[model samples]
Target: MKHIFKNGIIGLACLFSFNAMAENYTIGTGSQSGTYYPLGGILAKIWSENIEDFDMRAEVTAASVENTIKVSSNKQLAGIAMGNVVLQAHEGIKPFPRKMDVSVLFALYPNVVQFIVPADSDIKSIKDLKGKRISLGAPGSGTRVSATNILASLGITDKDIDAQSLNYTATTNAISAGQIDAGVIVGSVGVGAITELAFTHKIRILSFTADELKKVSEDNASYQSIEVPAESYKNVSAFNAPAVWNILIVNKNMDTDLAYQMTKVAFENMSKINQVISVTKFTTLENMNKLNGIDLHPGSLKYLKEQM
Candidate 1:
């Protein structure tokens, strides 16, 4: 079945995998200033350079959930998404209205949930969000989806706060302008936006309380406990949070040989990719193979098996 497409052309193939004669493609990545965009930019550059007949580029998007939607609709040949979101899309669960016919290309990185605030903001725990001004995330973005669920698990809701839906850049700017008390950003451990924010203003990354965390993990098994080390960004201290795996996804209809070659190229160009996607530096084929949110495309699985 075809899935939703956000401002892109949806391919005609929806019910089954099919090959296309054309080789041009676009990767739907996250915000221009976020981790996914840079990662996609590097990957697009690599694929364009290495694969003959490959005409590829990356576009800034709302990220994860939206990417999954677009890829499922064949609006994109491939995209990146959070593990939980891939599962949700494939299963036709909440945050998705219908099952998406999609497959995983490979697992990539993790996006940790970071609740940011000014250094002097009194809000410390998830509970403190009540009666506060907060920027959840852009209305349709993955950051908002995760942030909303995480807060709901701790008995907090939009009604409890002066909520505004804004993207990372706007949210961070709001915090700096003293317009919002806090903002929730799910990104790489040391996302560029956070790094830049810290360079000028004093900020704090909040940690969930034990009880809040217990509730969160119990409710959403997809979220794994993680600790962001001290000083990951300027003056941002160590803090605990939940993280979700990021996966590369593609339409199951992708040319099998093309998928295999693309998978191989990704591994071969890991070093260059690492410069833009720092989290990949810590991942490996072994750990990447351990991923379990969505079904792997047969083409991708075939390549992975050969490597094993």
Candidate 2:
């Protein structure tokens, strides 16, 4: 009995030691209804399962801008952010008060800027949105920044429209209820909020003309010209739109081995990730190099170099 008690005590001590050694970190993700949230949870699970003594949790945040700021300030170890916002943060541009030490882990997917308007509305083009009520996404979201930038390129500024800041769900809800004339959403193709709204309401997605695409590209290289494939949403035809890559970014201060392991595991488990979120199909090494402005993390760089 004495021997059994001693062994039991020893086992308890080992369990305590293992638990104490586990490192828990938070991956800042967008609102609960957004893609970033589930993706963050998938990633946290992947890292936790594969990495020894590592624990990660997904935190609901205000999306790109907030994630970039938080990750750079070391408030969170990592985050998913829009490539353009990351560039702005890196360069200390407006909306970002100072230069931040942020490095990309990888490009997760392209977030197409989707403009939604009621189907029966007279608004045929984004220009018609002038003097109309529109939601540009939540204040700290990358959608707002992208919408404002694209609109400005097309000569529609804040003064031209009644701009509202609402999250994906709220924006779609308001549109479905005919409260807003239009709204802008930035997310991977088949974003949930847009998908849900499409089912109940007849909507039209505004396409960017070649001239508008060229102008926006000239103004900001981060925006890419892409086509939304037909049937991506119910009754919505394929259309050309500008997109920005959503990337996993981390504080530059992250430990080399930890970052390396995270990148390696992420790439290796792309299949598993896709199972959780189909949009992760775009999360590939080829697309990883697409974000040119932000520097890659040294650990990620080392892993990528090994692949070469």
Candidate 3:
């Protein structure tokens, strides 16, 4: 009887230790109503369900700039950010309040700059936006920053256009109602907001000329020239547009092993993740390796190396 009791106590102790070792991590995602939130939620669910000894969850925040601040302040273990913002945050540029101690886990997708005009609008090219009413996305959003920079590069100032700060939904609705002449959306291609807008309204996506692309690239090195194929949206023909990269980042001080496990679980269970959110379709192994400039956490490197 004494031996049995001792063995039972020892087993209980081991079980308690194992449970205590479980790591709980939170990912800082974007606005509750935006694509980043749902995508991050799905990723958290996948990691929590599939990864052993690690529990993951998502927290909604302002967006890219806010996520970077949260990650830098150690308030969040990880975050999803626009790649352009990630680059700026590391260098302590415009959007970031100050220099940040953030590192990259992986590149997620391309945040395409989509310019939408009402079907009846006379606006035909990027330059047509001059003196026109347009929604430059919401304040504190990466979309607004990209829009401002792109327009600035083309020598189009805020004074040249009637710019409104609004979210994707509001911008879409405004355009449909003719409250705005054009809307600038910086999100993944086939995003829910854009999809819904296309279904309800006849819209045209504006294309960037070579000269315009050159100015945008020269002004903001983070901007990439991307060809958003025709039929990607409703009532739209094919055209090339400029876009910025998006990345998943984490606090520089996060536990190396835990970060490694999280990164590993994300990539490993990506298929399951995509089933929950189509935006995650962009998450892939090849793009994960293309992340440059942003310092990758050592643990992330370890996991990627193992996969290789």
lDDT of 2 by residue, 1-308 (tens): 01011213222122325436666689999988779999999999999999777779999999999999988777787899999999999999979999987889888899999999998989888779899999999999999999999999999999999999999999999999989999999998899998998899889899888998999999989998999887899988888999999999988766677778999999998899999999999888777767987778888988999987
> Candidate 2: deviation at residue 147, Å?
0.6
Taking the tens digit of each residue's C-alpha lDDT, what string does model 3 give over 1-308? 01011213222112224436655667888665567888888878877786665567898776787788877776666788887788888889877767788888887888888899987789999989999999998887788888888888888999999999988888888998889999998888887788888899899989999888888888788778888778888878887788877888877765576568778888878888778777677777767845567767777888888877
Residue 281, candidate 1: alpha-carbon lDDT: 77
Identify the runs in model 3 with alpha carbons over 4 angstroms from their true place.
Answer: 1-25, 52-54
224: Cα error in model 3, Å: 1.8
Query: What TM-scores do the predictions have?
Result: 0.91, 0.93, 0.88
Off by over 4 Å in 2: 1-21
Best by TM-score: 2
- lDDT by candidate, in order shown: 0.82, 0.87, 0.79
Model 1: weakest 10-residue lDDT segment is: 1-10
Q: Global lDDT for candidate 3?
A: 0.79
Residue 9, candidate 3: C-alpha displacement in angstroms = 36
Q: Evaluated with lDDT, which candidate comes out highest? A: 2
